[model samples]
Target: MACVLEAPLRMSVLSEVTASSRHYVDRLFDLDPQKVLQGVIDMKNAVIGNNKQKANLIVLGAVPRLLYLLQQETSSTELRTECAVVLGSLAMGTENNVKSLLDCHIIPALLQGLLSPDLKFIEACLRCLRTIFISPVTPEDLLYTDGTVISHLMALLSRSPYTQEYICQIFSHCCKGPDHQTILFNHGAVQNIAHLLVSTSYKVRMQALKCFSVLAFENPQVSMTLVNVSVDGELLPQIFVKMLQRDKPIEMQLTSAKCLILTTLPCLVRMCSKDRLLEERVEGAETLAYLIETDVELQRMASITDHLIVMLADYFKYPSSVSAITDIKRLDHDLKHAHELRQAAFKLYASLGANDEDIRKKPILESGAIELLCSLTQSENLALRVNGIWALMNMAFQAEQKIKSDILRGLSTEQLFQLLSDSDVNVLMKTLGLLRNLLSTRPHIDHIMSTHGKQIMQAVTLILEGEHNIEVKEQTLCILANIADGTTAKELIMTNDDILQKIKYYMSHSNAKLQLAAMFCISNLIWNEEEGKKPSLLMHRQVTILIKKLLLNSNICSAQCIGIQSVMGNIILGVVWIVGVVRRHEEDAESSLGETQGHSDNKQELERHRGGFHL
Candidate 1:
């Protein structure tokens, strides 16, 4: 073993061996892969003496064989280290196949590789572990499974000099899975990571801070726990003060700034709740909001959320906690930090709220943010107005009492109701979108009914009556459909003498979209044949208009045909009612005046004169 480990193999031999292995895997499928694997391993042992060339050959050419060998054998310390180099190479290579090599026992082998006396081997294994642990997949419930993954990772991180960097990288990868990250935190990853902030290597310190930031931002529980451990108990500020004095590396400074931001966003959320973290929450928000506003948007956006999510996932993986600590200097000497960075970050953060699902507040608040959002409802930018309305809706649903008054205060029953009258199709579309969400909340529904319901109905009725835009008209009908159970709008649209005339105009429009929408709107209103109370004269006129148009228009396609057919069905119902009325009139006249009404005087006469013969 010593001679094999000590012998300096020729570079040509190593190259030829590695090439042969690649050929076997890449082209010579007929070759025994086991023999190719053994040859690669033998060459790895012989080439160990030459660090530079050997590591490259093992990594670049022999990785597939090495991975295959890992499954076939209980790797010895030397073999394991060599295989780790190959794994690390594969990770760094174009073929990203290392994620599939998860092992229930690989952790111990990695630990053994980390302890190997060969410096090259140790470096390679450390790199390999860094790659392996970054897997985004929530390694299945390891309780009866791979729990050893975290334990073994912790053991190596505890002993490895690059512990901080490794954990940071792993956590960075873990940020993709919030639940899995929390699990890592439960296993003492947080405190161990925090210690690295004071490391001699600036790279290590930066990485540690980054991992902490990820944990603190993405997982609220971890954020709260971090606040308890670092801010409430006073651990973070001390580090901040110390960092201020040190000539920290640029990367380290950047990481610290990011960690500061990560810690602040969630802490601010908690602070908004008035908990024990009230002070820390306030301080953190002020700090982070400042950072976002003053820092470069690109840099902050790149890391703040990403890092926070990673740590969140790790903490979810393991929920262990150490003693709580908080640090405070009690002065507003906030660092002017990165000015351009802040401005860019703040704008980006504000923009992100539009896409962030977690910011689940109503579009209106009883008194707070919902009210603020509602105030912005009149913003000239359609996107802003839409987003503002959406935010208010979410707020109203999430914090009904908090946002109820704000919605009321911002727009009067009439003015707020008049918003439903906005000319912008997108604005109306968004309002309906907001209403759709608000209707989901019981109190919100009741509030809408109590405060703005009638006014809203009036506005919607006008749009349904005369709106020229097909999109607005269609969405308006849909909104009515959503609120159909309790409103008089449906009855008015179905039986109102004048509204029925407007619907007939739409049915006759040259635009098929308008015709289709009109058909749909009329169909929705005529749900259950309740028009028996109203006279059928206006309904008969509408039926006459549509039937005559359909029969004369041979160029109409199936969509129009279907719409006309639907209109025909409703018209037929109206025609039947009209026939009943005309027949009654004829009978009454015959009884009282002894005269019969002429068949030529029928409403169908008008339909026939209008060319209503075709189907």
Candidate 2:
């Protein structure tokens, strides 16, 4: 045991894996079926206990031969069955491992391998297919592109208890998105999956319910369809509602919430609109608004149905903080409910305007949601502050120039600047995102940056230099990119040497997204199609050395090299040279650093390039 642990993992893999290049891997073509079956069982036993064994076995090229064994017509049922079992064991590893198995067409092989009179082979094939389909990155689109895949899978839904459970799991994982949902619903998966809700097996019942949630995710049509399907004299939605009670298992209740999102919408929307007291109406709005706040499609549907957005807007009566509540003791529940309702309303406002530009700038803007959001950006409550800032950010996305001005004005210059350095990183990042969106158009960006240009740069510099994560810094660089796009704002950015230095440092960052963002900012700051701007002599000397170093290492891909070439031409030569470098200063700058410092700086530069572009 001690010696086994000491040996290298690669060499220590089971003899079945590395005995020869084609020992176990090529056993599928052997003339003796009994020998092939025995070999498959040995491999499965060796790989069953650990994922590393499975991964190593796959890396040693066991998947293709095992799949070939399962696909053989002349192979005996016992041989094919054990082949499926061994292949399923190999399928249980990282996404990359499963992706490798899939590249050999395991899905169709498993499906076609199920055609047999033997029950064990069918069970083995179903189990193997389920394992492959369970991967998050499985090519679900491949299942439908073949046209017969769903029909073939549906055929096994009622094969037996084992097939039922495995098939349901496969469907749960495969019904990933809207297109899959549409296809499955059209093929009568709703009735079959709903039938399992009353299944005697607890696992079957649970798997079917989970499958309902996957089908209903983001696809409102499936949710509504499930609501109408009657199972055992109870509507499917009614059965799930009962499952939500405390008497049911916790897992069932959670699954019920996911599957019943659409069915519960109309009731909550109506509850918000009934002629009730102000408090009750606010409670109803809070419940309904919170439900759809995180789902953009649900938000759009709710806003378009039953006057939902208008009803939600009525509850947005500003915040209920210590400043406004004169008698805290007297107005405890009422004020608390009001505050909860306002936060929910803020979230829904953000959701509603998330994708729809007209809704963002029009109704949300017209209903004073923007003003209420701005007021709460400075609130003492963290949830209220972040939600308010988030709502304003969504409203500013792709907004018109006038709408951008109104959002910025309503947010006020003082509050916007303060939120940029908010102690909560969530607030800080959302505020930065909001700033990027506000700088959408060149005209409006120039106008805002002209007035608050210096403060913006200072805030960005503080965030970049601080201990923020790569995401926050990436966003900061994005705002700089936006500012640099404007002719007027570019002047302020160009003057800040610190900002320029940060941009240059990020150009060599290990993270390609950060590198691309940094490169874009520098490019925008120096690029001028009309006047054809050039980098200053000092900046030119620095950036050119970095570019030449990048060229030497061949670290970036063809795409990145092409993108950076434009930035380089502007800095040094106009059209005749490598980068976008200007022609006039080529001779003088070449003698200074462009060509002179290329050698010393190459050795002095930090090792930044990791590998090929993953951007």
Candidate 3:
């Protein structure tokens, strides 16, 4: 115990034991059979629990001695097992230990032991080989160049389920580098890994999945081969989907998801090149989209590929037709497939443009995504409409003015307005959001106001009055705020007393965003008002009270609220004459008994003035 506690003492003891063990091991073959077995047993026991001790033994020349025993024709199975166990322990130690084993040429002996009839010998040999394979100091060129090591591992994969997991782990370690991945695939390792996916042992299956995932990652040829290989008429894609089931272990699901992403890379490259058949291209796009659906990094990677955006854009335009299928069930299946393709395309488009304006321009707008999305909004399928509107919404957010105009021209104004009445809450919500984004462009706002102001106003009012979704109402308020930017539009909105009332009501609502949006609309409505033209009646006592409450409410204070307060201050300053008129009325009332009633009547008159402001 003291030796374990003190590093120098431990090293001294290990050095003495290793030196004596080396002397015994050197004369092991010359000794009697029982003595040779005892010497090897003693060597194995010396390093069983201590990696530093094992490393010391390797430094003292135990590796070559152990390799000699493994290579001996007359060595007993017990002697060979002990030799393999010692070698495995040595290989599992420091980098110097692995380097010593490789320098002593022990890999061939370990490979030989893998073919032994004894399961324990084979397992020990595999453990050592796996350790060497994973060691950073191990020469990758040496292990993969001869092809013999990979072949032996593939052989062990078929030997027994007990050994298969270890062999799979070895393959996983070897498949780390691109050069090694090519070697493994060239030796049919990818196919073997695919076969092991159906292994009854979950451990084997997981290791195999990991091996394939490592092989598939960034190795285009390996990815292509895995996807092209078919077993029982099912490709690797189908098997990966099956492994991604909800009931499977999370590790398996995660591995399968990653592998699926890698497997689709080659297909995507080919699709981008336009070198594949239409069916193949569509299949690849669908698979890639499914694997990277909600994953941001993979989506970014997929978006940057050469022809991927163009290919997906074309698919968006001409979804696979389901009419060719004659059977009703097949027809249903094909229809669902078509719908999935459209959904995948739009989802990918949304992800691609979420952060990149170049993607929005090149892949989305220039690729005719706007036209396709416009057409999709008229589809009978609710999912397609919802996805199309959502994609359009993202496209319009913070977009260039010219791009916004192009999108507006591409979309059918009537069709878009009709979607505002959509039964699906999601569809309506997305449509309202899209409208809000479109209104961000000043030109688009002017066009909508001049051509379709009444319809647009009606749509917003209907949603505000009838819709229940808070998000939709918030978007509606944003649209009203934008529309009120123009004088004619402001007058149109202000004449509608109900719209004004709703805006005033929302100003005091519990939701801070709604309150802000309504305040913004009110601020824009009263912006730069003339003294005589001011909506004195509309700025009723209750309206002013609400604004004062908002100003004093600590919880409601935000950056946007502060901006609104500045605007409210400007509105008050602009209507200084109105304050003077109220003051004069107070003075007139102070001189008479009827002044109190007059003050009350004038307050009611101011309330009526609030209704007339064209907000």
Candidate 4:
């Protein structure tokens, strides 16, 4: 060998990686891991060398060693930061094995590092928390106790813009869990969010708003707290007004709109009583109503209306005992500024009968609202048609008996015959629904069934037999339950040859949605009782088959499982109820023949029980 010479050039601590340096790292990894670890230490010293090299070393079973280096008081500040970065990456990665942090007081030391004079150290701590938060499970207690994370974060942000930006990102990720969210809210997180609205950095504001949106999702009370803060005049309006004045980002605008829709609607209704809301109220009311009307591209309007109508009807039906609305005059008050709502309701009804221009030309044709709705079998949109039928249903229930009669007039034998043969299954299904209601009342049912009994029965048979749409089948099933009140219907359906096969076909249908609907129909059909025998022998057999099928499907949720149990339980109860009813009927018949017998209280109890079933 030539004269032995030591390598004269050692890598400087601040040297950054170049193409040759990267090649050197590659060779070190391939040739020897001892050399790679040496390289990692050198890179950590060299602010100039590969930061990636230090992080990569941790992935390969070196994270615990790196973290140990970070904890040593003698370690260089730069080296400690590099080690933390590597550890952070390891904790975030799928292959991390450094669980020994539990034994070492690493969390307290990391919190100390977060306050380091070196910016790199603070950045590294933020990154560490970020990585830890991404894990499926988070260790909250350690971070909360040592970091005192939220309080320290607020204090740091009050001092500097750059610090605020970094803290917002960390807080956004940390406050994702509901427990953390409650902690944040309890410790002035809402005010912190509001403070960031005017943040100098775009990223900081965005992150802060994102955090606020998540917190507000199931916690409208947070939004209420935000609104209650004394930042602006009359918080709700001020928020929207300020939103329009500023060049708001689209995401912020969307978030504001969603939060406002949820929190503000109820607030606005409450505010309606105040003189301030009434003064110059029409313009504001129209604007808000238009926004609600257009929200979700019109899908939510019908749902909203459904809720309001049901509330109104329930209140009308049972005032104090079952009041759906506590304030009787709210609708009247809303009507003052909500001319649009009144017009919209009329327009909604109009659409049921309208072709194209006929809609705009007339307030929906109420003269034959029911008949025209029945005829919308030709409409292509099934949802619209179904809704039309539902609207007619609500209209029929209007307190005015005239409205109900006008609906019934069109459901005569001739009209029903045409409806029964319509190609659109929903038309026939809805028609049957109307007929069921008409027949449920005194005099009319027996009258209609006697004249159009055979045809109406045939129509009912067709829907039960031939309808394929699950929704149509469900409606048809409910209609059958309504009409299946007497011996005539019972005999007709049981005797019909096609009926059993159709029921069997529905029971065997492969589609889950269809199966559920069919099951519900079958459940309702046999839910009632005949005398003391309980469920008829025929009904018991069908229910047993259903129970067997339901038990086999373990994928079902507890709610659906409970529903199945309820139906089965009711079926069993129905049998017992029927037995009791038969015994009571026999007892009454026997008592009528007795010379002297009176049990007025027993008769009254039976009457009350019978009253429970009438509606």
Candidate 5:
């Protein structure tokens, strides 16, 4: 009886434990919606607390569930926001997690959240969108369909500085395609971005500039739109220039520089249209000139625009007048405008002539640019004169023979001669460079020598004897060399005692460049002549010293080796010519003496024959 009672109690205890275990299993797998959301929140918190939890959550299907919660219309804002945040966090997680988020098609829902009024929700959505857009695997067309997503984001640009910054960044990514750039522009992105350029927030302004940069980069239509907007408002261009100023942050300045090249430059090129205001055209040309000076690509791009040449010529034809200014401020402003206009015009002219000889001739000369440049070279304003001569120099550098002839004929010999006496050293240097280019060609050499040869020689002599910059001295020496290239010019240079003394003086100077230039000048004087007819360059003591110095210097390593070698070779040839001349002179003297003695002997023989006939 005792054993039977113990067995029944054990069975009851086993049944009660089985019922409790089944109830606990049901509770663990509860399907309650609130319970499911709470569980998700806990997982999100865990993922946030420990980034390592993201991989675990991804493995457990958290991405799809969060995306589903975002798709639910009745989902609370908090829940939807949390879902977006969690999705964004996961997107920011591992590469696999991003792949998981993308696979769930979360972009549309996040874009919907962009329409939400709550800034945090919008920010979370933007973060998610930004990450998705930045991924290489994300299809470009994913966010773009009928332009709705881009339109919505552009609408959000006016919300807050933070929102504007994020929206601009998103647009920057979207603008990777021409179609996307067109869509963005169609939806007032250009106007919006132009306004954002003046935003009080530096971050917003930076992002806005970057958006403009991306949109305008290689997109001519968008660049034109931004430029038009800038012209109508006159604010955007100023903002661009302001950002480029030294006072702005370096980052802002750098971004501004890029915008100036990729956007402002193209816009300025287009703005060269004839109907544009004179002030607007001048500003555009000035900006282009400033940019092309620092970048070769810009120079090439700017040169191709045929209208820019026309517009610049038009401005040169009728430049802004400061003559009527009575007020001091107006006078100052007019003076500044005149200076900038002249500088920009000349620089653009130089850039256009950099490679193409046709550009140097057809458009420039047709537009009367040569006449304006010639006139400006004589301007009382030093800046005008400097830039004018500089433009002429670029025009003449490596120019075709025809182009050089055109330049010489366009600028009178007297004007060019007067430029040689300009008080400004820069003016003098550029004038010499132009003269060198002109004198390099055979046709222009006669005009230069006949008209201004004496004055040029005198000016060069003065500059050489005076205390001037080494560069100026070197350029003067080059001009002298070019002058000596022609037979007439060479004779004139050789006969001038003062110029010869100057050349000899520079040959012995401590500055190696001056010495080299002098050697070059001397070598040209005696090059390609008959044996005994070459000028006696070897007669000067400085020439001997220079030869020895060059021989010694050639043995040493130097950056100037090739140039030095060429000069040394020319000098050696000159020396050999001199030696040949000396030998030819000696042989001629011996032949003459032989003839004289033979003639004397013949005369005595004739006289003896006559006396024998008489006997």
Candidate 6:
């Protein structure tokens, strides 16, 4: 009879908790947020583990008010923290509950809450975020586009052991793809997370293992990265093996096996071997290209593996040499095979040399791969041309003067101009990029432009005046800016009226970077740093006035502030020079102080802005 009474009593208590949960949720909008928050916290704990009860409260509208209090109740850290805790409970309830929580900008608000100096508040918010990230409804790739978020979270990894655990869980859920893998790896995730493998807390250590497994799942480069990363005098592989071999639980040992059994690294190397199988080689090349495309460390690692770059570059020489095929019947198949091989090889070259110069350029130059790449750029195949041209761009990036000259000469001026005029905007953009890289530094600009100035300028004018997009035009201005950096090229640049007219038009461009790019040219042409004078004050009078006016109205940000400083310095130097000449040439007391100034409007313009410049 007493046992029968216990069930009724428990039901009555649970009923009261649900009603209290609703009452506090509704009272959350009170003038004082603190009054109802403790009740909310207590009631939330009672209903938290009950999925059905959580779904019922969400239907009664708890999640939205909690988010409001989290975002708005800034003065009360306790209120926000409770709200975050309750939201975490709701996030773990059901798919519908997670969906409702995610619908109202909860992720970004929680991200903001994580920045608070209140450690408890941050922990609550991080746990809430971890719950949301764990849900199938809240996929990470949809939320994050770059490694920026990872970098921010990784910055907080050492705040506490709990922070490390939650952040690792967040990374595990969020890092589901290759892009995320590369991003997290780039933000020092390997080293930071490895330290947690030795943490005294079992939760932190396990979570760190989970993150590595998610990061290394099917990703050979990252798997290799994880295995080799040293963690507190213990290797990651050793830790995993010890977890499996030691007295850990069956559950943990199973997880260790799952995370440690990644086979991608060995498989990728085998797939990339130099057997005579064309289709397999093509697949291998494309996959490896994707793997190392964004990670420079992976590129460096792959380059040191038994002369991998040399072997990849040889695909262009042996497999694709159509003339080497003498048999009549196999000619068609060989030609098809050759195109696929070259395309894949070019794609590899583009990524292999993307971030590192010595990796690909050394082997490519030694093996004379540049000539083959140059020849492929003229191929009628659209993909072959694009990939070939992009590889050349990387080859020329930050290269010495001789390499720039070699790339330009190898492509030949006529072939380059044809590339510029190619009907494909993608190819044209790449050609413009190649030109930018070739003419990137002072010596590179002087040497490349001296030999191909006419044709290059013609290409510039063609792109600038033609029906290309604003990006094409912007890069064209950048090219002009690079030309203006030449010791003797500034004069050559100022002499071209069409280029000058285009520069003037872009000075007022709606895009700020484009406008700054044009100003870069103007700054270069007029400002002479070494001589401390205006080298080519020969800019059209109207162009000079336009620059002055734009200077006062420009909203250029810090990235291009150097352009602004250069323009301001050049214009002031001219005024100061003219002022000094008049002061020195004065012969009598008849000369007034006004004689030393330029036009009155120009003087007032300078005077108005001069106070704003420090130097």
Enumerate clash totals for all models, in the order shown: 68, 13, 8, 12, 0, 0
User: Could you report the Cα RMSD, in angstroms, for every candidate shown?
Assistant: 14.7, 15.3, 11.3, 18.1, 17.2, 18.2
Q: Encode model 4's per-residue lDDT on 1-615: one tens digit a residue.
A: 111111221133114335544543343334354554555555444333444443334222244455556666766676677667655654553322223333344456677776676777777776676556545455555556643667776766665555666666666666556677677788787776667656667776666666666665545456556556544334543554454434887876776666555445434322322243333333333343344443332223222321322221221121223244466575456534343332233334433222222321222332334555555433454554555555555444312344445565655556556665666765566655655555554344445455556776677676666635766765665554444444344444445546544654555565444444444544444433444322232433443444444444443323544544444443334334334444454567455323122333433343344311111
How many Å off is the CA of 19 in candidate 5? 28
What lDDT does each candidate get? Answer: 0.48, 0.70, 0.70, 0.48, 0.67, 0.72
Over all chains combined, what TM-score does candidate 4 have? 0.43
Supply candidate 4's per-residue lDDT for 81: 73
Count clashing residue pairs in model 1. Answer: 68
Cα-based TM-score, every candidate: 0.43, 0.48, 0.57, 0.43, 0.56, 0.51
Q: Per-residue lDDT of 68-99 in model 2, one digit per residue for the tens?
A: 67777878788888888887887776666677
What is the lDDT for 229 in model 6?
72
Q: Which ten residues in a row have the lowest lDDT in candidate 4?
A: 1-10
Which one is best on TM-score?
3
Query: Model 3, stretches more than 4 Å misplaced?
Result: 1-38, 64-84, 93-126, 135-142, 145-166, 177-182, 195-206, 216-292, 297-366, 375-385, 395-428, 435-470, 476-506, 509-513, 516-549, 552-615
Q: In terms of TM-score, how similar is model 6 to the real structure? A: 0.51
Model 5 accuracy (lDDT, Cα): 0.67
The digit string of per-residue lDDT tens for model 5 on 122-143 reads 8778877887777776776776
Top-lDDT candidate index: 6
Looking at model 6, residue 182 earns an lDDT score of 84
- Which scores greater on lDDT, model 2 or model 3? 2
In the range 85-113, model 1's lDDT, one tens digit per residue, is: 55554444322233224422344455555
User: Could you give candidate 3's per-residue lDDT for residues 417-495 as a string of tens digits?
Assistant: 7788888989998888877777764556676577767878888888888847788888888889888776556666767
Residue clash pairs of candidate 6: none
Q: Candidate 4, overall lDDT?
A: 0.48
